[model samples]
Target: PSRTEGNTRLYTDEDLQRLEFILNLARDLGVNISGIAIILQMRERMEEMQRQIHDFVQYIQEEVLSRATAATDASRGAIVPVRRPMVTPASQNTRKK
Candidate 1:
């Protein structure tokens, strides 16, 4: 709304408060809206990168665990003997001819 008594237009109290906030942010805090937006974007990118790294690490760990388990089972199957029979040596050699 504007008053017809003067040529210049006046702003409402809410507009003044918002303008003051923007001015203080630029002047007092030495921060601009562009810089703040860039910072937020960079932070979001960093978080995404971190999540990807974590997922890769977990995939590598699972792969390593699966390989280890398969290797253990193969080794167990390929092993020659884990126990021996209680038999006399003379008796064992007698059947070999």
Candidate 2:
């Protein structure tokens, strides 16, 4: 109901908190405004990923920790990734078969 405003919905306190969180994240990461917009678009995706990580930790705790409790996972099941070459724009284009 922000009719006096020029075509922008006034954000509530909770919305401000969310926007603040996104802005803080962007600031901490040194991301640009456009990048921040992209991050906001994927905000729900980021939240989902965090939730999944929490669920996975709980699973590992119930299954692994219960069987053999440790100070931490340590070297029990660690993952190491290999580096890959950057994708060139020419290669990035998806071609139809």
Candidate 3:
């Protein structure tokens, strides 16, 4: 927080958004300062993990495609994309029972 000549703290858009988020956690969710701190830390960690997972998946996909292309001969057809099987909600429910 930076102060102006009038001694008023100037808040940026990002700072305002963070303040609003903290207020919501305190007023709406009834989370105290310590709890809010913990929640924010966990959220940051989860976001970091998600980013790492996405990078790893991308790297693996690129490596596999490159290797496949190198291994294929002129007689063999070009690399074919493999489609993953989609699991619908109905299939999930059946498995549960």
Number of the top candidate by TM-score? 3
Name the candidate that leads on lDDT: 3
lDDT of 3 by residue, 1-97 (tens): 8999999999999889888999999999999999999998998899999999999999999999988887775538777789999976668768889
lDDT of 1 by residue, 1-97 (tens): 4755766778899768766766776788888899656655786799999999999999999999999999898898575756777886688668889
Q: Model 1, poorest ten-residue lDDT window?
A: 35-44
Candidate 3 lDDT for residue 9: 100
In candidate 2, list every pair of residues with a backbone clash. Answer: none
TM-score per prediction, in order, is 0.52, 0.36, 0.60
lDDT (C-alpha) at residue 51 in model 1: 100
Clashes of each: 0, 0, 0
Off by over 4 Å in 1: 1-29, 80-97
Candidates in descending TM-score order: 3, 1, 2
Q: Runs in model 2 with CA error above 4 Å?
A: 1-12, 19-37, 68-97
lDDT of each: 0.81, 0.77, 0.91
Model 2, 25-97: lDDT tens digits are 7778788888777878798789899999999999987987666655455656777687999987755346643
